[model samples]
Target: MAETTNDTATLDCLIAGGGYVGLSVAVAVKHAAPHMNVLVVDAAPEDALSTDERASAIAAAASRMLGQLGLWEDMLKEAQPINEMIVTDSRTTDPVRPVFLTFGDVNEESNEPFAHMVPNKVLVGALRGKAKEVGVTILHGETVDDFITSDPTSEITLGSGKKLRTRLLIAADGVRSSLRDKAGIRTVHWDYDQMGLVTTVSHERPHHGRAEEHFLPGGPFATLPLPDKDGKHRSSLVWTEPTANAKRLMEAGDFTFELELESRFGHKLGEISVAGPRKAFPLGLTLARDFIRHRFALVGDAAHGIHPIAGQGLNLGFKDAAALAQTIVEADRLGLDIGMETVLERYQLWRRFDTVQMGLVTDMLNRLFSNDITPLRMVRSFGLGLVDRMPGIKKMFIDQAAGRAGTNPALLNGEAI
Candidate 1:
């Protein structure tokens, strides 16, 4: 349990939203700078994260960061490493889906899987425990209703009418972030008219750590391997469809839903059954024009939210946490004010270009593959095949997927800040 805060005492940092990104920020800052006081205010109930059935793919770089933070060892027990990935382009009714591309291990030397599929509950639980262990206070069922930025501090008002002041205010509240809006951060946004249907399935046979992405006329259907439970083989599914179609599928009976699912899933893994509740999340591209102002900073979905076509949404958020933590810790070590605009600008500059580039890439890929135009299909297929045949190009893609391609911060490289 977290200790109660004193309204009159200013904190080194106050974080909004206790999800993965927010918790990561708190833990990283407190772990490296033990003298800095950190507090996290989460709007959800205390048990909300324990019930999340969804899962996310943690890239190699992210796993390394977790290991450095002393949380990956426990998470690795439940995580399923993705040894291979195959891509296919076909219609839902197609009996045979030809593989257009395939990726093996990240590289020859490392022989390490590029990513791991981790349950959301497990990840959140681990982060929460670490945050507590590092002496960071977390206030559940509380929210930052409003904030006033001053020269050296931001005075935050909670929903319950309590007030606190912090030298730095970070928002990791998610894509539809109220805090971002309150900060007057404008975004370049658009709806894809699509929704991603997420669920888990049990199959007759094991997935052997193989992940598949099938590009149908509607959208991409991704089947990612999961660790077995009670001797049963299971996999996580992310099936994308048009808004109306997604709602219809979700509303359908189990039998009807399975029938439609089989059309896209096929019998590659033999008999299958939905093993978890199904949920649909609307898809869109949201990129904040500015990531910082005064004593405020935006991380994770508050800064940018992109299509899940590449399974990079959460990984991108991890990158933001790493960069921002590095910036903050270094500033504090140098006797500089961590929340000043000049100090926060370094974080914004480091992440903005990468965020924009990824958003554009995912947008282009989603647009190119979500339709069945013969000409566009031919071009995309040719491009996939060409890249597959080029080992060098394929390796580059693998590196990018592993989150090791660019100018990364120290934490991303598994180093301490």
Candidate 2:
């Protein structure tokens, strides 16, 4: 609906933001149709390395998609598989002790792990490399100065004074997506009174590749395993706490802070030491009411950003990348405008429910655990116990983790994405 500068040449798709979402979308399209001229315009400096320390969880569904794309093999060397998940309400120190709940596998599912941990850098590296192999062009250090599309083409003007034209334009920029805002797409967003403190830690014992989620009073404290540097098991941590508490933790000396962390994370890992610098991101949800307009479409965080309590943020983006790819691929086969309204609407419909549903679940998890309310805590913990005991109910969650429970795009199911 918004106007973009007209460039003489157009691309099949012009993706803004070089993060996981943008790179993924580009790679997915190129993988399906190498002839489609896809280009990614990113503002990150050219010197930016591929192995960023920030870690993320790739859900089982997303993993299967990568397997289809031939990226799983490349990512496997670096990814740490999560075979089991242990969840506990750590806020209450009652002798009855908070229940420990573990999510296992279902029949014919190979008892495979729920997800895997991939550092942001490695995943992007694999994607960028695969994209080039598939003939997708990437322009780093180029910022999107402006963008607009009329009828037959969508044009983009970069900060470097370069231009490109594409049949379709995708905004995978992220929660603060300029392209989405520029398109006059309204976003419904709200930040919780919390921040997630992310870092790595060294442990004395082996993690057994089990991911742990502690429902602390402030929020969720997630400890996911990683390879050790010197024969010791290490783990990445995303500890959500009140904003003030996070600020204090950030400022505190490492020795003093690890003491606090150790108290909560000690048992499983034995003695733990901070292995990496702490990074903080405020927790929030962002939902774009409209995912498509005219010749444009939004994907990844640009479309919807939900709570990371379930570690589904990046996986959700992968879902978008995969679905958008399939939609465009099918349109190309049908000889329709890649940016046509009908095709773009298909992507919107497929991803909207998944995004909205995950948003609601994560939002509820965040709210339900962020307080010291006695009754709520009792009910929540009991509910966890109830689900753990019920084979059918627990299987529902396992199926969801396996990307089989809900109506999802074919790509996430490892078909095409």
Candidate 3:
């Protein structure tokens, strides 16, 4: 319970943004250190999560973390395991798109699929429920208007005029985070000038849990398998295109849109029709110069935002949650200040390199594939084919994709902190 003094409540940690990363951090810390009081505040209304129709690719290690957090059993019912994945590079008008790479084997150690397609609503709902069970207090439709960090405590003023003091303040408030701006943290940012048009489609034939990524001149179009809904075969799509083209497509009529969609989606899954409302998100890369400061820290997209070319943005956010939670829990066990810069530095060092590497990799991939250069396409296709033929290399790639090939934190390894 938070200690109350006058009109202010004091907590061990106060997190901005009640999304998955923020909720996960609250649950992890409070679950491991039950004596601490954790709170999450989000600007969005409580009902916002229920209306999200998008989906994310949760890596194997992330699933393990979720299981250890005691939230996976219910989520597993709706999750769709990605049993296989194929990559192809072709034009939108190509008669046939030849596969350049294929992945089908499960993780060698865990025998788990590399990843799973989970609906955003299901994931957020599970996290919210678990956070509540772990005794993490949440404030909906509220924002942290401003905050002042002074050594042992950070005093925050909420949008509702409520005041709170916390030992640590964490920002998980999306890419354009106001809290981060208040902290005066600089970011290395760039816009891709592309928009990812996301929607769900019902198909005549089942996908059989196979994920596909087609790299065309505009960008990569990914069709990720989803569990059948009411006997309807379904898949979630992340169709990338230039900003102008994306706007045009989004404004197009249903018949016209489906015709264009079919040209790229092909008939492999039989006829496809939109089953959900379409949304477009602009693509960009934003990496914070620093992940932490005295009594403050950043997590999830608040720290870094990368292209979805590799489908690892959410997974990377999960990695931050695990690492930051582990760092805080361990520091508290030693009777040290969890918000101190010395302790937070451990997390920044642990995550910075990996985050920057992924950002650069995704940028390079987007630039390389989102074009029509003849020589470049041939080179990339050959590279993909070469990687596909090498079993050892392929296994390494799969392990990386599964989030098992690294110096992972305890939570990511499914171990309790």
Q: Could you report the Cα RMSD, in angstroms, for every candidate shown?
A: 1.1, 3.1, 1.3
Q: Candidate 1 lDDT, tens digit per residue, 1-417? A: 238766786898999999999999999999899999999999998899767877899999899899899999999999999999999998887778989999976477676689999999999999999998999999999999999999678899999988899999999999999999999999999999999999999999999999999999999999999999888999999999999999999999999999999889999899999999999999999999999998999999999999999999899999999999999999999999999999999999999999999999999999999999999999998999998999999999988998888999888888999
- Per-candidate TM-score against the hidden true structure: 0.99, 0.94, 0.98
Candidate 3 lDDT: 0.92
Predicted candidate 2 versus true structure: per-residue lDDT over 1-417, tens digit per residue: 112333465678888888888888888888888878788877886559643576678878888888888888889888888888878885635333355578866636455577888877788888888877887777777788777777788677788676767788888778888888888999889988788888988888898888888887878888898866677788999888888988999999988898888766756557778877788888788999989987899988889888788887887788888888888988898899989887799988988888888899999989998788899988988888888888888878877766666766676777863
Q: Candidate 2: give its CA RMSD in angstroms.
A: 3.1
lDDT of 3 by residue, 1-417 (tens): 632222467888999999989998999898899999898997888899778887889998899899999988789999999999999999988898999999886555577899999999999998988888888888888889999999678889988777889999999999999999999999999999999999999999999999999999999999999999988999999999999999999999999999989999999989899999999999999999999999999999999999999989989999999999999999999999999999999999999999999999999999999999999999999999999999989888888888888899998899999
Cα distance off (Å), candidate 1, residue 341 = 0.5
Q: Residue 167 in candidate 3 has what lDDT?
A: 95
**Model 2 stretches with alpha carbons more than 4 Å out:** 1-7, 92-97
The residue pairs found clashing in candidate 1 are none
Tell me the spans in candidate 3 whose CA falls farther than 4 Å from its real position.
Answer: 2-6
Name the lDDT value of residue 140 in candidate 2. Answer: 78
Question: Where's the lowest-lDDT run of ten residues in candidate 3?
Answer: 1-10
Ranking by TM-score: 1, 3, 2
